[model samples]
Target chain A: MWGHVMSDEKKPVRKKLKAASEASRFMANYYHELDAASQKGQPKIAWCTSVGPAEILRALGFLVYFPETHAAMLGATRMSTELIPEANALGYSPDICSYLTADIGAFLRGVTPLSRIYKGIEAIPKPDVLVFNTNQCRDVQDWFAWYGKKFDAPVLGIYTHRNVGKITEAHVASIAKQMQELIEPLEKVSGRSFDLDRLKRVVALSRACSELWRNVLETASAKPSPLTFFDGTTLMGPAVVGRGTREAVDVYKILLAELNDRIKDKEGAIEDERFRIYWDGMPVWGRLRAHSDLFSGLKASVLASTYCNSWIFSALDENDPFNSMARAYTELFIVRSDDEKETYIKKMLELFKVDGVIYHDAKTCPNNTNCRYGMPQRLEQQTGLPSLTINADLNDMRMISDEQTQTNVEAFIEQLEENQT
Target chain B: MKSKPCYAGVDVGASRTKVAILDTSKNLIGHAVKKSGTDFTATADACLILALKMAGKKKSDIKNTVSTGYGRKNVSFARDTKTEIGCHAKGCFLYFPFATTIIDIGGQDNKVIKLDRSGKRTGFKMNRKCAAGTGAFLEEMAMRLDVSLEEMNGLASQSKNMIKLGSFCTVFSATEVLENIRQGKNLPDIVKGVYYSMIKRVLEMDALTEKVVMTGGVVAHNAFMVKMTEEMIGRKILVPDYPQLTGAIGAALYAMQNKP
Candidate 1:
């Protein structure tokens, strides 16, 4: 009811990716395997941060589960707004990460959106061990600690340096030592010996998978991008949850091939690509479809984002798994200094040939929200590209006013139009 | 004699609907303002009819129409629609013709838009999902003070010492006003305090340029606010002759420029 009045005839149709089915299947299989492992209790369950050392857990015979992915699921299903208040009732501030609030609240209420999708899964897999890295944010440590306390699971943390401008050997060594310390605890929980060969194999698969995922994202640099940020968010499921596995590599290979074919045929993610925009923060999980449709209607392709490109771990090397994992995770855009972030984003804008930038000032995700620090104004001064900041939350729908966002986005497009002419 | 074709712009805002008609030479020939009631399309049509009558022209004389403001899309007769941001910028630039920051305090939103000397927009910011610094905040404060919205401006002007409100939230400010009234504070002082709060909120939204122009319905009615803002910033602020009609006039200018 609250949207633009563009006619159906005028709205450009979104071209669906052919490999989405394979990616979906791959994700389902990965979740089901974890669910089975949880039930059997044979393969130990390890809860890891999305960007944590998942390969180590997998190699040590632990079924790794990412609670952040489950939080994203809660957000996507629109259940987060209802469930977040449950955590709030328990003294969690509404200003903290909505994902933590919603996931913890869902756990407290004995409900999950996953039950409806994955048959026979009443709740998320319980963890035998919980691992986290502070590269993403300090909040993930708090989030994992809560679960570790409740489940009586051993909590392992790899505290990395923040605001890193350049990934130094000292930084890498510090994180690598912390990661190396996890092996003994991980082996004790899994009742298995640590295998360096197994870790090497898993790390190699992760490297290959990430390379293919990067290629899939880079395909957007082509004229009339073969994909949009909306597509990347959904397609990056394998790269997030299924990394360090052959299934993840296989899924990305299929995806990259299909995108290449789309590029060869001069096909675009939308019918008309009048403008290309760079998105510089977390996705509004609940409003993804609405936003995707909104941009498609405007004939604008949001071709790049700091969120989707966060998973490209090109520095990963199988020969030096511990140090490489440390280097790859430490070099994340979220952990970088503002200077490095600006350099990275400017390169992305030029690489994608973007016409404008949209900075989503997500209220709950201050770490991901870049506009609060005058990055938008600074970027505009340097690149001469217009930028608009929309205030919303990644998971909290209350923070979003559809009418206000619609007006701001339309005005930004108009600004781009004026600049072009 | 055949009538010359004129361009029309309708600004269907959250609180009011305005229509501005311009001749082929971009002269402001007619304009009308009316409260935008429940039905935005109906309010827009009525304003357009009144504006056309004021211009002594028929609806057939309008060759192009552009609509702006919050309800811009609801105007059925508009050939196209532009945002209130662009419209305000265009409208203000037409009068100032220089690098200026335009701060528009509308019914439900406030915008601080910057433009270069060449009329290109440098950047802009709007109030984020709040009604603290707009006309809505003033209206709420007026109701809480049990005074007419029009009387508050005069009351604020008559204040000997203004009380500054600590909270920026409209709801909190209303409670603060009641507490002041219970404390036997002077009515004029409280009213001026409310005005100061509004100005402080807007100023915090963005930094003003060397040349700042204030517009919109609030600026048109509340001249004391303009004086207070100038005193606070220690600079003379510019105002258009008809502040409320600038958005509509800008829309009309756009209609004229894009006329088929």
Candidate 2:
């Protein structure tokens, strides 16, 4: 609800800075696969997780692309799933993963069913280097492998280890060598030097912003506080993409100011949070809105979520990007077991002060699986909080049961109300 | 009399191929299940041939044919192919009509589907790239449990203590099962726990928060259906009367609707 105020005379300049200039800088292109035009004059080459990849590339004055995001967009608009049988018809087969087949179709057809949104997509200049992190899905590795073979583009991949609780010597050495390798192409692409001091300084700025954002989440524990996970979703951009920069600092200052004002005013982000809720694990990208909409329609509010947070406060800490990254990886609820996942779940429940948790075990993810076989029962045994678990790809809706899901949720709430009495 | 219009459906299961045939109104005329071969097309043909013979109809007698399952399109006979999902949704809605959610735990993969009142394919989450909590996993355990695949469920119902199958990955779950056995955990509890573990993976993968209409080869065969429902969802699970045939029925209906 807070708008940036500007002097009347400087309005035009601020508008350009926010929209046009920044849009030009948002040049990061992070597609899992780049099509073959064999064009030489590409802008930048980089990779990132589905969430941070595009934003980081843009920060580097590069264009960002993502195959999964494109796939989800297709699923969202309903054109991609419609073409599944056709793709399978041509030879892909029903056995093939839909993302690959749909992408192959979208590439061959030359126009996505919703092509206008990504105009000049294929024509965007070539990437100087491709950058990626092994954070979400292992399919990313294969996706990039295909891209590397197709374009023979210089690829830089980051390893966000799945099962490891801490970064071992092997993990550090492998990625350290990778980080060393990143130096050459990155320098060659931007024609800029990889200044270690500059990078550290930038990460520090990012850390500051994250701390503030983390505090924003922490403050929500109080009676009527500033923001919710919904508002924080909008605020997640800078911490992810705009980190380690003066602009990052400026943007966060504005956000924290608004939040503090809300705290002083004793108000919540929304007018009336009908049913406070906590979201556990990654936010189902395709279903995020549908999820929120479903809950919102029922006058149920999602006050916080694990996906929107992603342990940002810890990972973005200035103490040593390497050490901090490793420490953050160790704390992830999915990669750990027993005490860790339970401790975090308890913390989230306590911090969000919500009545229940909607856990999203995204299909196709290796690191995320749990709490069945009386596991959720254990949660019931321990925390005495209600738990609702559902299955479906984070975005793929080829098979989802919304009505049944709604029924379960309503019944759970009914039981919760009865229990409280 | 109108020539009996013959219809066919094939299920490309993990270890086996099941085929069914029906007249135009969709009454099952004949059905056959056979071990799947290595080659895709050959397995499909063998299943189709067996099903056609059982229906007492030559391949040429079929006016229209629809194919479903993992191998639907791989079959040379299918005019077109649809995912096991669309066919299942269509098939389940025809039977239950009010079934808004369908959970199919198959041999190779677990598919959780959400259907509308009219049986339109809406949203879904299939399992990861491997078999974690699926029919294949169950069979492997059944072999170790000394219970026939057909009798494992019945034996499971007779057990007293809960064996903990703690691993979520099938590979890990297998090792974990052996470890629990070595630790002297009761067999029924272990089998029940294994089923629950698989159910848990399905829950995380699909985001399932509903009363699920459970169907598939495993649901029909598993005797611990009640315990599985309670453990996986911490609630009750409902299944169709003849759950295993849902996929075949869906395939036939899909074949009939889009016949061109």
Candidate 3:
């Protein structure tokens, strides 16, 4: 009774960015420099959070290392699941941020994914100090504290107000004052005096890189976007790790020009871009390629995302580096209330001309996951666009249900098709 | 005799495989359901043959075929595949033809799909990383109770005092069932509690609209679930004539509608 079935449809091919190699080299160089400094102990190494005060560390002549970046590498290399249980064995709940668990687990196991990429790198650079800003989540503080205790390094952090709707002068002053206090501890750790001129120059470089990154993201607003959120996640390396440096600014410049050229030539990241979707919440670091392929196969382009756009620090002003840095970090989307978040998402949807939104209800990272608070329903009611919530984690592969995700995403695309017709 | 042109739909669920045949008039003329087993392609072919025999038709008579559910892509005879969510929404909408909240409790998963008055899907949600409130849960509970899956529905109907299960996880619920059994609770009451827990789990997945429809293999075998759901929601719940075949029927409808 068996009859012939149709052949499988053609799979969509992803277009590679020409500047990706340059970005990779730049990142590798940054890591190599940190490794060198850690080995020589000439310029002390300071571990900073991804969104922490890296500019100050750079100005103090300390090589800055971001553990979150290392955590992402662990996730992308698909080694997080194996190492995460090590942290759980240390009495850390599996429910906390997977990045934290995976990083600590790797440390406890004395392994690094970076060692495979860069030869002779035994582990992440040893830190003389660890700095963090609690604007993103309290997990960063706790995550840094563990390393601080292990390395016998001083752990310093700037605690910012949560659920912030408006940034008042008082809020900026409070954060700026706290950042100013870090100068003394940072100087002692690095054995270099604080220089305001150098800080201004570093902040200015960071501001230039942020603008270029913002411009690269905005290029997706064009018809048939030149880049996808998956691309943004990779290309934002410099903006996240090498920020406040001339090299970061140069990398973004090369990337922006390449994207602009793609737009000029009417090129798209995917073979077909029939639907534009806005992704909210954290990236499923391990499944980026799979998710990208799934959407590309459905003729959809995830044009914009809150995670990639988090790197845009437009409020950074060189003239008032400390206060502007304070204002910029405080105004982050993750640190904002639901009201502010909703307004920001609505604006992004319009800017990108999105047909739908997909909310990643990441299992481990509640701070980054927004769908639990009825945001998807509220956004749909306001925008009249359909939304789908996929439950997965950034680094925890155990939480993902691949079959369910495929079914839900396919059904969501069908719903969007019906709406369009 | 010249056979009339017909369309077919096959739904290869995790537990069962179903097939439905529809004539040009859109009437479900024939259907069949069987254990999916290991070979989805063979089971699907067997179901289609049985359904076609019932319809008094042959393979050559079917103009188009569509497949749905978990093993949808495994149907070698199907020309296209649709998701279970869309098929369920379409199947329920064909009967009610109005705004509806469709709760489908299948073997391995559950879906809460919302449709507008025009039969367009307004929203949808699926169970995340769990198998509670599904046929698999009921089967596990039945195994724990040392009863057949078919007997639980009838046992639930005969309950005098229904024992409420506190846990929604299937594994935990199974342990709870054992505890109640150990405490000398009646089998009927415990079975009723299992049904209650299943219904409550699906209801909590999403809100019901003015109209609520229940479908899927679990609902097909358990009529008492529909009655209990009505009593819980304080309203009448709609059920298609063959709730188990709605997804397959909906797929058949798509075949008929999109025929070349």
Candidate 4:
């Protein structure tokens, strides 16, 4: 048995961040509470986007369910394909973000993978109201608005202007003002008073978790990075779903510790870790495993990404919660100019010490993917780091050609490998 | 003494399977291009056999095989697979040997790959979720215009005035073609517009470098496209002797370099 388990005799087992189990449990419980909200009949449930000010909802004694998270879950479970056609039948083009299609399709079909994963739940807790911010994409505004219309629920949207230069004080004030105005509509739906103290407490916890998550992501800066973008994508769920909660902070603390330990042991996400690459844009959610294996098989690990780093709160100021939240949300890398985006990419490349970049051109999100055609060239000119852009859809499984994607990625790794010589 | 080792590259494109066999001297000995059909495995095997016969070599003469393109993995006999991006870059660089941008408009997809002067690929971009720039779009337009794909090049070259297609989508472009035909637009003019649309779609994928090399079965069949691309970019575009065999040749190069 020992002989059979010799280094070259046995295939290497891909080691994941040990804290993943704890994080999954935290997410499951978070979902469980949201699913139980209607049964308890006391706390109301609200549907929100991943980037919405969920701390406010948490502070207001309502359980929040991020439909985007659920939609991603649908994608991972291979159930999205079944749900997408339902949306197609209802006039949603396959060209729209698959998250929207799958969510609406699941709702239209009256089922969810979550319901099946956790027994005794009919579906994701239906919301009493819907809330979202316009910091990310047009899809956020349209997706949440669709739910608001379907449920006849009052919708509260916090709109952020696309920042052309550095974020201004006026920008912060305007969005902070919206945060104040949001209280009334939320109060009306939840039938509860908005407590400022509770919000401050939630914001403090959110800041702590963001710090821990940032540290966890930074651990990949070590040679033979102990984490991959694939791991970060899954580990990021707590930061999105459990933001503003002590439980989420605890989860990240554990994750950060495990990552640091891996660094100490000289452990890597991929066994040889010959090269590190950065991934930009949304993941090909349906083909995450296939994509991950494509790189790891070549001894190249995608150690860092703009997608997972979107959750970090490097700009957040806990002392002035609302104003800082406004600044942090508005200055997202996605909405910034190509020149400014290059500056940030340069910083990430230095910090992660990556050899190359893989820019994923997700089909539906034009706001994020359209600017990509010029990015690879500009970044290469500036940093001397090569990049490859592979076309894919975030949730739509139909659009991906595994053969094409594999060929592109393999060739990219080959170039990186050749550069080593 | 061992006979000179030969390397083989198989490009399993979505629409067609291509094979190129090269001797150790890096000279192309034989090549074949055939429709991919439904079974990539069978098509790839058939292509390899046809090319091997053309080269007058037995299977034992081949030392290594590498595959690329959309159906790369379906080639069961290949020792390895490479992306069409790397292959296209290597293939084009072999011809130009300078900082070059490669535009490959295949049957179902289009790729724009950039390379440094040393033939190292610096970056690349592929058309996303649209068929406007690929050979499929042209095939649809050809069917809609009731002309053979082979005749499209000559017809477009004869046009005195080119008609512009408003819709970039294949389905919508077909309707646009019909509407143009009904409006009594000249056949040559309509075909010319289709070529312009194809060129515009690919050019929009990325910014071109000083030296641009165009490859693929579409360009191989439609020499007029090269002229159209040159006029549009206001610069001479480069093409390999056998445009359809570039990806396969790139794979063959990889095979020669990475022999087992």
Candidate 5:
């Protein structure tokens, strides 16, 4: 809200992403349906991690809900600060993942942003079952298990191996075997038979949606960058929570078309795009607007980031759904080696043509904080692109000093400008 | 005699405000440093007036002005604001003219800025979120030791058996300082420990390049701190003629370069 000036037109003029609003509306409707799932004879609710096998859950006739996405919404709406202390009061450490703490806090308060803002539900729908995989973070298991006990729901966890080197067929087969073993417990919890044919179709739709989302993000590579990573963070809601459904695919299809049209018309995120930057780690949930404006005010747009691109499943194989899903999910950039990370960072810098990089070291997340201290220096040495990291929390605004962060960013931009001269 | 236009730079730092005026040929004509009181605008204006008088010119003789430091925006008369990092690099480069790693220990922060051979900034870091390696910590230590700030440098230089501070944190170091004082440690030895603690914290912000240049208000008041820093790193460290005025001088240089 600090740096972004919204359009003043009475009609909704799309200065930002139109798909972001559509995704928000879709999420509100989805939550409403979840509230009335039993009355409307809709699918049962299943809580899962963002990177979990949501397609399988959809195939099992369950409405997938991601607590992480809900936490991010609370963060975006500036309500996480109000709810996080409730979890801290319950003995959750302030140093734990902010998403886990915020979700627990929100649940303990018996309220959701859906009811307060969107007028959709009085509370988040209680899960009939919970499922998770440890592809990205270690907190998901504990987060889901706690909710399972709180709501008297059955919990199902699929263990995934960390891919240290190249992911082999054996790794894929092992995870696929676990996926097969997972169905019986899920079937028992939802009281529905698992159908491979339906799962195959859902997996196909999920792959299609991921492709469209990747293409949408790639449009920023156009000269002047049609959108910034801030837009991507908002528009990424459907891809994370509503991955397998036709609605998710449709959202990205619309977003991809809009971004393509913007590229054709030479529209840019900032008026005068002077320097492009590669953003590392998560967005400072409470201060996204402040940071966004700080860069846009300097005519620099964060054209790409490693956070939003985490959901791009370009490695997914539709023909071999389970095995390919195993490889695709396990081989994420977050769980990769330093050499792999270096290649990925270098590739994004080249593709986006960024002049430098900015890293938000989320104090509450150890997973996101890896390779950060040394990565900037290594990247600069390898690619000749400069980088700076500011320490802040993702949801907790108390850990951030706006003035200090702004000063560091201004000095960094000034250095980038000097390099150009 | 012809009345010629001159440029000015104002650095409104946390502890003090500095002003430097330069003539057309890029010479440091006059400069002033004063305690930054409650009102930053008033203090900056006072500093500018004093500097202009020393340069034998009125305020109207200034053609352009640039500002820097934590309170850069508070200078109402400045036409534009440059970052302290950029200004520091430019000011040090004017003296060194080579690839340099500058360690500027300021009032509330410390900065480690690296520059390439062509005088462009390659990398830089600022330590503002903490008070471990800053002049604020020195003042706090001095107050805790019940000694005046001016006596710290001389006392540190006179230490025969120097004590090493057990903690790098300002609060903890202050507690340790109190404990040592209660245990009857020598005053100069305790002061020397404080100096060593400050230098150790500053050096850890970033690796020092071969040509290390130290600047800022802390270095201006404490020459022994620089001597200890050189000793710690086991190499010679370069410093500007007026260490506290480097940022202001760089801002004035910016004003000169931007003149229409």
Candidate 6:
């Protein structure tokens, strides 16, 4: 939990006023609908997302799998793009979105090269229900909408509105109540008992993951840093799909061992690492190498990203799932308002101690992009950290200005270096 | 002494592969396009062989080979694979140096390229995601109702009524097309709706949206440029003689360049 603590300087402090007046009544009406008298079997629900939201749901005992994560690994191996045309022939528009078109294309062609959903290249299993949080990008939301329409299943869009200005008590209460209400539907669908104890356990797991993630970020504070964002990214997959599980914990332990070994050797994710930069916002989905090479020549190592640390909440499950999940979901960096968002950045600067931040203003993504204008200014003014705002689409070339983006990044790094002396 | 071997540039597109051949002086000796096959290797070979036969040269006469498009890396025969972006920039510089913006509406993807006087890749954007305005989207709608792609465009230009394409998703748009038809909207008006909707989608991504016009698959098939789009944006969109084949010609001419 980067934070959800109450702050005073923040304004527009309206505490769950609407929920108190309206949504609360709806919640009571729905809660009695369950009452342990009418509800029977817990519905078989599956959580779906990229790395960020998957970890949060995993803590709550929800079975989760990441389609984008699976798709990216395929893309990394160069399978999805190959399947684009066939997917188009099957009625998926190639222009609709590359990932969707490609994956469906691969499915239609029946020639995808992936080995498995997990290692050893096995078949992917489909879940009865899908849950997604809208903290990452709106594309996931739209993509999931297709999934919902195709499967004709219930689609839950968890909107985590970013508080760009400042946070107040009203903000926390408004969101907390939303979180409590959002889960009731799940309880109705799953028939899983919702108790304070369960949420607390989920919260504890969130804290553990966040704590481990914080330690990893702290490792970047070293001069000529022992770890790179690549190392952090690889470790993130486990959290993405298996968080709150014993398997996820083991995945991190193994990854941590490997990363620690590399750090001790003073080896970077890529050798000849020079600049240690922070990557903010969603990754350019398709042009990953191009995105990396945009700064690769500068010896720049993107050590931390806002997306990578997004799900890292501080509250850990001492025990129970309800309190833990409630607190953790409520505490997500993107889910919180001005107080939490600003404080999260401040904490990252204190922890990672990086010199620069490249705020990737993903063109189509309002959730991540909305925070940039005011956020960069505030972070720089207080931390004295140099920041550059680059406009590019997340994973789509439709919005990237490669030449201008390159020139900007180069100039920003130069300006940063000039000031270091 | 070794003679400077000829080079081949083949664009294995979604529906077709347009190939071009050039010698040491980088002159375009021959050019041909064939229906792209199901397999990448087969399509690459068919296009290359056709270009070679037209050039009166053997496969060995080809010193180097380049493949571009989404299938760039899959070309088992290519010496090196460059993205369609790089190749398009090189080709557009050679073909239309003054054309600041290049819009390529292939069967599936829509890409907008910005080039400098020197043809360097100044910046470019592709609709890697979203199908609200692509040529493929229009084609699907055309086939669903058993209307020809040509008739889809021609009939659309004839209509004056506005048929709003409310949903941004392609499948949903197809459904919307059907829904409009059920609502007694005339065939021509439905076609008009698709063209108008596409232009709006294009405007969202193109930095030079208002200033540019037809030069890809969409221009050729549904040859009618969305007049409403031009009027809405208040700018003229330049249309080349053959918008469909411009990219191939651009690729062919790019191969003609002697410059490194």
> Over the stretch A291-377, how does candidate 2's per-residue lDDT look in tens digits?
655565545566777666663645544446544544454455544545566667677777777777666554444344454444565
- The digit string of per-residue lDDT tens for model 3 on B196-246 reads 999989988988976898999999999999999999999999999999999
Off by over 4 Å in 3: none
- TM-score (all chains, Cα) for each model: 0.97, 0.53, 0.99, 0.90, 0.95, 0.53
lDDT of 3: 0.92
Candidate 5 lDDT over A210-239, as tens digits, reads 898899889989997888998888888888
Q: Quick one: ranking by lDDT, best first?
A: 3, 1, 5, 4, 2, 6
Candidate 1, A1-421: lDDT as tens digits:
2111223348896789989999989878888888888888868899999999999999998888999999998888898898889998998888999889989999999999889788888879989999998787888999999999999999999897989997899999999999999999888999999999999999999999999999999999999899999999889999999899998999998999999999999999999899999999999999999999988888999988999999999888999999999999999999899999999999999999999999999888888999988898889889999899999988888889999999889888888888678
For model 1, the stretches where C-alpha displacement exceeds 4 angstroms are: A1-9
Q: How well is candidate 3 docked (DockQ)?
A: 0.68
Second chain only: TM-score per model? 0.98, 0.88, 0.98, 0.98, 0.98, 0.81
Question: Please, what are the lDDT tens digits per residue for candidate 6 over residues B128-221?
Answer: 3466678778778888777887677678779888687877788998989889878888888888888877876776555672236456657766
| Residue range A249-314, candidate 4, lDDT tens digits | 999988888888889999998898888999988888788887787788778889899989888876
Model 3 RMSD, rounded to 1 decimal: 1.1
- Model 6 over residues A117-203: C-alpha lDDT tens digits? 223333333444567655554556766776677667677756655543444445545545655655666665555655665555555
Would you give me the overall lDDT of model 6?
0.59
When summed lDDT is taken over every stretch of 10 residues in candidate 4 chain A, the lowest stretch is A1-10
Q: Which parts of model 4 are misplaced by more than 4 Å?
A: A1-14, A85-97, A138-142, A149-153, A184-195, A314-319, A334-340, A370-373, B1-3
Pairs clashing within candidate 4: A407-B83
TM-score, candidate number 2: 0.53
Best by TM-score: 3
For every model in order, the fraction of real contacts preserved is 0.33, 0.00, 0.67, 0.35, 0.35, 0.00
- Judging by DockQ against the true structure, name the best candidate: 3
Report the lDDT tens digits of candidate 3 across residue range A304-345. 999999999999999999999999999999999899999999
- Give i-RMS (Å) per prediction: 6.6, 22.6, 1.8, 8.9, 9.1, 20.1
